[model samples]
Target: MSADYDLLIIGGGINGAGIARDAAGRGAKVLLVEKDDLASHTSSASTKLVHGGLRYLEHFEFRLVRESLIERERLLKIAPHIIWPLRFVLPHDKGLRPKWMLRLGLFLYDNLGGRKLLPPTRTVDLRQLPHAEILEDRLIKGFEYSDCWVEDARLVVLNAMDARERGAEIRTRTECTGLLRGDTHWTAMLHGEQGDARVTARIVINAAGPWVDGVLDNAIPGIKHQNLRLVKGSHLVFPKLYEGRHAYIFQNKDNRIVFAIPYEHDFTLVGTTDALFTGDPDKVEISSEEARYICDAINEYLSVDVTPEQAIWSYSGVRPLYEDNSGNNSTVTRDYVFELDDKDGAPPILSIFGGKITTYRKLAEHALEKIGGFEDRSWTADACLPGGDIDPARFDSFFAEKMAQYPWFDPEGVRRLLRAYGTRIDRIIGSAADAGDLGQHFGATLYEAELQYLVEEEFAASAEDVLWRRSKLGLHIDAEGQERVADWFSART
Candidate 1:
């Protein structure tokens, strides 16, 4: 039987969305399905930094760090609106990782990826104004380095949107229930909002992330495909802890690092405990222990002390890391590995094991190359996602232009839109002379127009999808406004 698509990609997370975008750009007929919203799980739950993993130097994962560092600049260039540079302060605590050693690692990290575009690491005195009042007395010395911040969920959505524009079919709220291999093609059973349908494809890519093993078992029965080590990373959102745009990377006595980042204007994002997780990925939540650990880690470096009860919001996601049999969960290799099963010219199913957001574009390119059908090229590196066509250095100019163009709208709301939509801000504010022209007021800066644009362009089906993932408006929008947005969706459906 003939195949319905050149590529059938399962999972709508960053990896799968990226693969769909790249493959479709190469002229492949692609179909990508997700059991939930794009980036609803791990992709949306990242620490939201596009860094080279400075600590990875300890484990000596040079290649991974190098690739990530290189991608850091590339991503910033391509998506300047949602991505930009931020400084990180790594203090030299006396008892852990010596100062000289830290210098050596920073040196390597600085030069590893042909460092350009971002500033290099430099030493600093934490005794200075910002740090003196914020951090502990002992943390008098530190090094400040650069990394880019990303709207993680927006990255995934933009990739999927780009793929759809390139002729790929992206189906959210769609699940691939089963897979059957054949000589020339594979058949998949899909259960989605419209009901069940069977589809065929010449190649299948299993980028299911946390559910990779489950998908593998469904594809090739009778084999226990226990290749994943689900590591749960959780984060806490607290009222602003410090007064700087710079983020802090605190080294704990346990040899782990926790980050305190400036978040959503009103809160500090602190987090990311590396604990082994065996629960359902969908129901992953921050354990009380993890929360306390994070608070303790924060207390060690910051002058102000915090308790678990003070946290306003928390989230957790399991990293579907390839089980490398490491002694510690924190030390598990983050590099990706692939499993290809195509014996004697039988239909091939490529299963992606492990990967991080920083290297997702490289991962997609490599995955396509491994499958060996599309034109092998670096087209994606040069191509821009949906609204990311502006030059990185000129983003401020672009924003200024948009602000001027929509002078009648609230300046702050326009700024937020530009950050989320980039060049596509016009799509929402096109020809609207005033705020009243943008449709009904839901709450805060959210109008019916922007919400409509999200539903129409970004595949947003719910209020949570709008306020939380597509943008962090949930932090600012009031509860009555949020409920009205929900009502608006329900009225439409």
Candidate 2:
């Protein structure tokens, strides 16, 4: 039987959207369905970094670190609007790992993966710097190194947009309910806002993230599978802790590390506790203990202590780490694993086990290799994502040009638009002469023009889609402003 699509991807996180973009560029008839909004879960809930995991060196994950580092450079080049360099300050704690060990790790990090473009790691005397005032008096030295920050959820949406532009079907809020596989094709049942629908595809790629096993079970009933180990990571957002563009990485007594990053212009983003998680992934939230744990971890290094009550926002995500039989939850591999199921003449099903945001494009390339039958070689390596065509080296020049072109727009508002949309800012700005021409203001520089562009071009269906995922304006807007945006979406829909 003839198939409707060449490939059917069941997930809309980074992996699925990335694969859709890659496969569609290769001329495949692709259909990607997401059970929720793109990056609604794990992808959006990342620590928002594109770094070579420095701590992974302790686990001897040199290969993953190298690949991630190399890809970090590539991603920064391709998506300069959303991904850019940020220096991380890691204070040397006398009670934790020795300074020598930290130096060795940084040295390896500097040399490994053919470092270029980004500045190399350097030792800093905390006693002389403002960081000294931020940290405890006991800490006298620190190391600062380069890593890129990412608007993670926006990355997913941009990938999906590029995929769709390349002729892939992107369906959000669409759940793959069931699958019936045949020798040459598989029929998939999907439920979404429109209603139930079925599509046949020659291949099925299950990138369901936390629900990978569940999707597999639903597709091929009773098949033995034990591939994913669910680990919950939680993050907290507090009012700005310090005044700097540089972020801080604190080392805990247990050898774990936590980050305090500048976020949303007015808040510090502190994160991530690794704890074993079971049960439904949808219900996952940061526990009181987890919040306390994060507060205590940061308080160990900071002179001004923080409490859980100070956290204005918090989020939790469950990582579907490939079960490698590792004893420690944090030690489980962040690398991706693919399990291809093809028996006799049956159609193939490639299930993505585990992956991180930094290496998503490479993961897609490798996934295509595993699926086979594509004539085109790797193209995303050189191709830019949507609105990512601006040269990384000339980003400042480009921003200046935009500033001159739209002198009527507020400088900060223009900067925000450029950061979110890059060259595509014109699509939102259009012929607008001033702020009033941009249409209704939804607070925090979110105008009706941008909202309309998101709805029409970016597949943003709700106010949350615009405020949170497409951009982080939700952090700045009040509840009343949010309600107005919601009303706008409701009225339009």
Candidate 3:
């Protein structure tokens, strides 16, 4: 295959895909290689909120906070279907920060960004509102604010899809095994469906998230960088415990917060335990202790107590943060930094260290600016990602029209189709007249047609890619259904 390109990105996570999409849109020929399916790593496994982390205000990360807030507005415009506004209720802790202080922080968060399209924060009386009824009696007041929630994995896929649409090549199940500096270009060895292939590129980007250091040590020997630090974070999905559409944010005694958000219409997502890690990112898993820790944290603040047995699913991922040597793990930086190496003009290699999903767009723009001295003007700022063509204001009407078009489709199914696939649901379901026409049912909301479309169009290769990354049906499907999917995928390959 042709190797003449301006950029080659390692890791198909958000940062790599984002950079690939941005670079390709700017007339830069780009090739992205992922060891597994897109977002099989940390990209898909996130708390899945696009916000200026409210807690970051404590650490005084003003720059990251402001940038993230601005990007929230930007990403909402670009991918309205996948990223939509949600109101978070933070129950006031009488002892934590005082009411006036919380109000001041909310004021800063609301006005930090351009503040368009989403409602501003407001104080709520816990004694009278429905949202307040669920809170513990000790919490007498709270603050409600706006933030965008996203289908994390789909965001990664849409970036790759958009990159492909812009003439970029994306290789899944392709591991970058070797990197060597050629006479004039950098040669990268890729092993995948076509077997091993040697490709050449003018620049190589190491956006390999948690595996950035390993890629450098093995693929490009002797490459030294003093940036990345992989910290493990874990989350748990439990049976729905409350009955409101609003999400809750509870402050822990240790000063960290846990979120309990409505998930899958019948479940809640609670998580995120941050602990320093020194093992292989690939081997990271949520330990029993970590799971219990999260469960206990939630039980300490919420009205309903949750136990480990109540958890339906749990996931863990390593955040590839830039080493800041902060005294506390929670105080470490969430902002990203890029390391651009161009020794003796022997094909530039840029290594990305820390980033969050909310700011991936801006991170990509900045990464490309350093990858090359000259390129087409930045075009991704206003460019809509693939399938993000629906007007934000018309989402309700458009969804209504789709329901009319496929009257047999369940309303929940229609909403999922629109949220996950955007305006492209028509392509997946096609002209199917009934549920039977959608193909074999694998339990819950999964069907053979959607699986096939994911594999055929979105680069899904394995069962985990379908069950965990592409969708969260694993939480609902039984062992038999999983076996059927595994058998089907194995037989197809």
Candidate 4:
């Protein structure tokens, strides 16, 4: 059968976008379809850390930890603007895990992954620091370790952008309704705002994060497949809990950990409760109980007790973890698994399960290897994603240069732009003599020029795409500003 594309990828999360970029770079004719805005689910709802899951060491997931650690450094280098080093403070909880055990875990984490650019773990005397007032007095000591923080949604967008630049067709808000497999190709019926269309591809890569099994069941009915344990993880955003650049990893009585990280320059992002989820992934929200659980978990360690009413915002996502039959939801493995169905010479369908943001690129490489038609050598290891060409060692010099070039812009605004757009800032700010030239001011440094760039270059269809995913300005802007931005999009569309 003749195929319209060499590969058709379902889902627009990190994994799907990564695979599309890799496959397109490898010279495959690729088409990536998304049911909603990219990173609208689990990919965006993460704690937003690129770490070697320090707790995974307790699960004896040595390989996963090592691979994640290696990828962490690589990602920092490739996307230095959005991805940068973040130090995590783990306060000692005597009742939960002893000092010696914590020390042992930190020791292994520092050594397990090839420790390179990031600094190794070190003990801290929390009592000596001014921020000690914010912590319970019993937590006199803690350990500081390295990880990277990412603008999670931007990572997904960048991957999709790079894939599109490499000749892959990216279709957002496009749902793959049905799939019919032939001996040499698979025909997919796609329905979107534009209506329905059929796309034939030589292969199908289902990188649907939480919809992997759902896609398979709809496409190939009557096929026995591995069950996915859908675990809902939720987070809460509160006014800055502490005044520090470092984030905190708190230990709870249930042996689960919650992170309170600095967010949006004005708030603290804390969260993540693991409860077995049975509802639709798209409709998942932070339940009141989950919100109380998060507050209770962090309250045990922080001096300032938190209540649900104090929460400014919250989010939840269902992780499509491969069913490992673990007794606890928190114990589920974060490693990815690939299932390939290619019986009787029919076109292959490779379905991905259980992956994290840190290991997405490697997962894509392995996915292509499993599908088999691509060149054996991997190329993404050294290639930088768009706007990520800055030298990690000299990011300061680069920012200084940008400020010099855009003297008319506010220093803080330029810094924010550099972080979000990196070298691509020029494209957004192009030839603007001053702030007024940047067009209608929506709010908080967001301008019409930047919004246009997002709609045209990136796949941003509406205002929330710009306010939330493309940038976290939603946290800063008020209702009036948000409504104005929405009106602008509505009038234009």
TM-score of 4: 0.98
Q: After superposition, how far is residue 277 of candidate 3 from its true place, in Å?
A: 1.1
TM-score of 3: 0.96
Overall local distance difference test of candidate 3: 0.86
- Assess every candidate by TM-score: 0.99, 0.99, 0.96, 0.98
* Model 3 worst lDDT run, 10 consecutive residues: 218-227
Give a tens-digit lDDT track for model 3, residues 120-220: 99888877667544666777888999998998998999999999988999998899999987756788888997899988998889999988877777646
Tell how far residue 122 is off in model 3, in angstroms. 0.8
Q: What's the best-to-worst order under lDDT?
A: 2, 1, 4, 3
Winning model by lDDT? 2
lDDT of 4 at 476: 89
Q: Which residue ranges in model 2 land beyond 4 Å of their true spot?
A: none
Model 2: lowest-lDDT 10 consecutive positions: 125-134
Error of 4 at 340 (Å): 0.7
Local error of candidate 3 at 49, Å? 0.7
lDDT of 4 by residue, 242-291 (tens): 88799999988888899999998899999899999988897999998999
Q: State the lDDT of candidate 2 residue by residue for 82-123, as single tens digits.
A: 998999999998878999999999999988889888999999
Off by over 4 Å in 1: none
Residue 393 of model 1 has an lDDT of 85
lDDT score for residue 131 of model 1 = 92
